[model samples]
Target: MQAILEEYLPNVMEIPDEFIEATQETIYMTVYTSLIAGVLGLFFGILLVVTRPGGILEQRVFFNILDQIVNIVRSIPFIILLALLVTVTRFIVGTSIGATAALVPLIVGVVPFYARQVEVALLEVDPGVVEAAEAMGTSPIGIIFRVYLLEGLPGIIRVSALSIINVISLTAMAGAVGAGGLGNLAVTRGYNRFQTDVTWVALIIILIVVFISQAISNWLIKKVSH
Candidate 1:
């Protein structure tokens, strides 16, 4: 196995440690960003749904402000966002390079996007169900927990899967800018050095990561739907 892999991916084999480190960094950035962004996105998403007009906790002013913020942040391209957040990332992590520093931009970029996803998921819940819950005198918290979250689980899963895949891509992009990961490996060690085998290996590794994420998400969605 080792001989075959080395023959096909000589560059990667030459720097086994770097390849391993890059892979770890990519996984770290993706998982860390996903978990943190997932919580924040759900909160903002829930707020967006609940504070909008006619919602259980309607507050147009708050909703509009939040909506606009999410939109604005979402509008910024991830690469540009990474550049824009350099100072902020430096402040948070004490250096604007590496996987840790990349977390700031990743979370910032993903939160609003996943929030929108969450908002859409929650919105898809039948209004009649919400009305019935309201008629039953269910508290806002109860309704949010039981009706919005429970009913929107599948949609949320679907969007989350999409978001996780997006995060994987972003991690690679983040690597492009010195956030050491497979992206960094591919760019710095592979593409820049004209090592096509290394580049292909890095790409294949990323694709495997994405495929695993999709598979898990599909399984979860199927189970939830059933």
Candidate 2:
């Protein structure tokens, strides 16, 4: 067994340290991007709901402008958006070719997407519940927090999970542009160097990260629902 093990060790593919670092970068980008995007998305979503026609704080002007902004931003493909935001990214992060620089575009690209999801989630809340809250003389702010958000918590969790998954994909694309992550490793070491083993390893690691994220999201949904 020792003789066979020694023979196999030489044939085994060694994982590179950069690949490991890239994986960590991907995780970091996803986490911080999701957190910032989630908060901003939630705020914008609430504004969209409250400023709509016949809504609690109806304002045609505000709603039209905000709605148009979201639609316009969401229409741009993420890759193009990333390129378009290069100047912004450089200004914010002092560079546009690393995980930190990648984060700027990641958060910006996901914000409108997540905002639409949040709007849909909040809209799913029963109007009757909102009316009841108003009947109790609950302030608009109170209803937004206590009724809309609380009742929509389950839906919010689901959408948030979806957004996180989307961000993971985005990070992979960001990696293609020299954003240090699994995607970059796959491109540079795996594809460029003809290292199929490295490619497969990176793919597997990405899948594992995605699976864990989904599992945690599902658990949170169940826990909060109960």
Candidate 3:
């Protein structure tokens, strides 16, 4: 095992840029999906916070409906969700064989996950801030966007970072379909061919991604919170 790793490490380290086109694809897809998902997540998060019982808007009906929707979507397994949205993916992305093809599922998967995260984060904020906002005659939308969200910004960043990390993982699995990414590389060249070295390389790359995301997220939270 030692000799094998020693021999393969150099070659693995020397993979040409061409071999990593799909890796870049994963990054691009993840970023685009994160942007779309992040916005949708924030919207729903604020909606959840504001429309809950005794919240700024306090519409139980609206809150229940949104809650059920989030619960149902969240319950669906991600792999199944990916398979279920095949048509939508092709329609929007034009081809179901590349990173673009993966965007639809990525967004669908990330949005609900991040929305819940955002809701959880915002719900942790002190209730007095919301009450003060209402007492000041702040609009429902204004209070949600300005007060709850701003106060919970650090938690939001933490959740956003977590969502991005999960998105990266899901993107890797997408390689099982025609969606290309580091996962495809691991599947095709690493696992199938018994090249464990390639598998380790891909895994390391993913870990790097997680670490970078965490670091950047922490930095953002500190900067914004202060």
Q: What lDDT score is found at residue 128 in candidate 3? A: 91
* Candidates in order: C-alpha RMSD to true structure: 1.1, 2.4, 2.6
Pick by lDDT: 1 or 2, better one: 1
lDDT for each residue of candidate 3 in 1-226, tens digit (9 for 90 to 100): 8677568675465564735786698788778988999999889988888889887778999999999998899888888988899888878878777888888888888888889999999999998988888899988878877888789989999999999998998899887676887888888877888778778888888788779888999999889987
Model 3 worst lDDT window (10 residues): 10-19
TM-score per model over all chains? 0.97, 0.93, 0.92
CA lDDT of 199 in candidate 2? Answer: 76
Best candidate (score: TM-score): 1
Error of 3 at 129 (Å): 1.3
**Clashes per prediction?**
0, 0, 0
TM-score winner between 1 and 2, please give it. 1
- Model 3 reaches what TM-score against the true structure? 0.92
Where model 1 places Cα greater than 4 Å from the true spot, the runs are 1-4
Ranking by lDDT: 1, 2, 3
Kindly provide the TM-score of model 1 when superposed on the true structure, using C-alpha atoms: 0.97
Rank order (by TM-score, best first)? 1, 2, 3
